[model samples]
Target: MKFDVAVVGASPAGLSAAASSARTDARTVLIDRDLTSVPNANTIFEGMASAACLNVEPFSIHQVRGMRLISPSGHSLEIDAGGHFLDRKGFYAHYLNSAADYGAEIIESEVRSVSRSADGMELFLSTGDVIDARIVIDAAGVDSQLASSLGIKTMRHPDDVAWAIEVDVRHPGIGEEDRFEYWVGSIAPGWKATFSPAGEDMATLGVFVRRHGRDVQRFLETFLKKFISRRAGSHPGLERMRILGTRRGGDPIAVLPGRIVDDGIMVTGGAAAQSGLAYSMRAGEICGDVAGRAALERDPSRERLSEYSRRWWRELGFEYILGRASLERLRSMSDDEIDRLFISLSGRNLLVPGGLWRKSANAAFQLTKAMPSMLPRFLLNLLRF
Candidate 1:
């Protein structure tokens, strides 16, 4: 196969990269190990809105009113501008199809090795085929093989990595409400256990905990049992609810890498430590657009593609810094401290720190006043790390 641009990974970043490159009439090819298990970011409402901006439908989307934050003792706070819940499978399919529609060839194959020469880059595939492209985009997730092959370092440190487990459940009372519930407790220790609704009768319950010296399943189960037991009395449908499916993955909750562009290559999305769906989509679109123009000029050199790296950081670097600091602070907080943090922020706009911190200066100020003790941790992490 020969193309002007070859994108590795079929996730949001790679798909968008292919689409953008092809839009410039560049011969684009998107390669993935398997099309069926394309990873999902769970597609937040803002992300769906972005997909619309990119002219792609989410396939089937469920609107969520807001998120309800709960303390360890069960105090609750709800935010009004909640996010969207998406049909994961449908959204992935739509993204892939949209890329193909843009004249990007979709290929199902794994890259066995990667090499570069004066002419371009070459990828040897496990299917006993070779691919040639003038430029390469690595959008593979946390365990990115191509990035490694290109000598790119991991974006996150041990402390910045988290183990996440999500289980789908058919709970009668779960999605009946417009708001999702999040609980902070010992089971999830600094992090919160989340119950995100998918439909009237389906929801996803999950958590992400520090990856150091812990059993992922055991922690997940403990959180599930305690959370369900507490909410069961109120909902009355918890007694017979069964797990429909389970998914486990690593989460890189860290600042973006210092550089995402190298000779003949660009990296984006989770592989670049752009964690949230909205952040990843924005990064992907920017990188893709830049890569498309660079490929059109027949220049994939690091100096040429550095514009993509600079634009991403200029627009989103602050949020990524704050997000990393927030995650680190959450990990350092005691259970009681987590409870206090939630209680103080309860009913006050629910501007939860990770993705939601960028909204409302007043909310951010109020939170600082409420949890003055966490400031040191946040600053220390931001400065030291």
Candidate 2:
């Protein structure tokens, strides 16, 4: 089969790209190994709904008002943002249908090899079929084996990659107030543990660790026993909780790739290390539009495709950079230091990047009151280039 543009991976980014390209009158095709089993899809389901232009009401089960971060000492800080818990599988199907409705050909096959020639790009699939495209989009995600072959680099630092495991827990204490909880400093060193309520009496509790060889299950088990026991006295239903479903995967958490496009190709979504759902979708939108137009114009050169990278940075690059910096600083700090940092920054409305400038000023003032020695590091993050 031949197309003007072929998108690899049917992830939110890939689907959105296909949809955008097809809508622009480009003959677009999307291929994936398995479209339904998107590991990180649930990680940012609600945000993706808007970024990919999918409605969440049919699939969403709960609303999230904000995030709460807790330190080892139990000191906590809350940030307000609207979100929702969604039916992840349903969301993928919905996106696929949307792409198809926009006239994108959806194929369920693994890309065995990607070869570029003078004419265009040829993708060899596992089913012994060859698909051709004037331009190809690499949205194959963080673990994509095809990225390096295409000359796209992924996360560079070990600290930038995290392996996580999450399980569904049934507890009567789970509330409908829509809150996400983060346990730092104690649960998982270098990376934090998160609890997101999926619905009434059900929640997802997961832990992320920086090192690759570490056992995520053991950490999650220990955390469930220790942390839940600690809070069981206040919320008695925790003692009666049981696991419903479990999922685990390696997550690439890093700054966006330095370059996301090459001759006859463009990279989007997790494959570009723009792993956050909102960021990936927006980046995909830009890539798809640019690549679609480029394909239609019969010019898929790197120079023409560079606009996607430029536009992505202009829209959401700073947020990813700042977020990566923040995580790095947190990972470097000792548990005691993190406790102090959390305590110092507690009770302040901490919206990332938006209210960050003011929050940093307040954090500096409060750090001086609590742990004056760490003021420089805190200030460094806010003021660093």
lDDT score, candidate 1, position 271: 81
Q: Cα lDDT of model 1 overall?
A: 0.74
lDDT of 1 by residue, 263-354 (tens): 88888877887776666767877887888788889998899989998888777776677767766676666778877887787656544443
lDDT top scorer:
2
- Screening candidate 1 with a backbone cut-off below 3 angstroms (N, C-alpha, C), the clashing residue pairs are 45-84
The sequence of per-residue lDDT tens digits that candidate 2 reaches over residues 43-148 is 3544435644556677666878878888877777887766777777777788789889999998999999999876899999999999989999998877776757
Q: List the lowest-lDDT window of 10 residues for candidate 2.
A: 348-357
Q: Please, what is the whole-model Cα lDDT of each candidate in the order they appear?
A: 0.74, 0.76
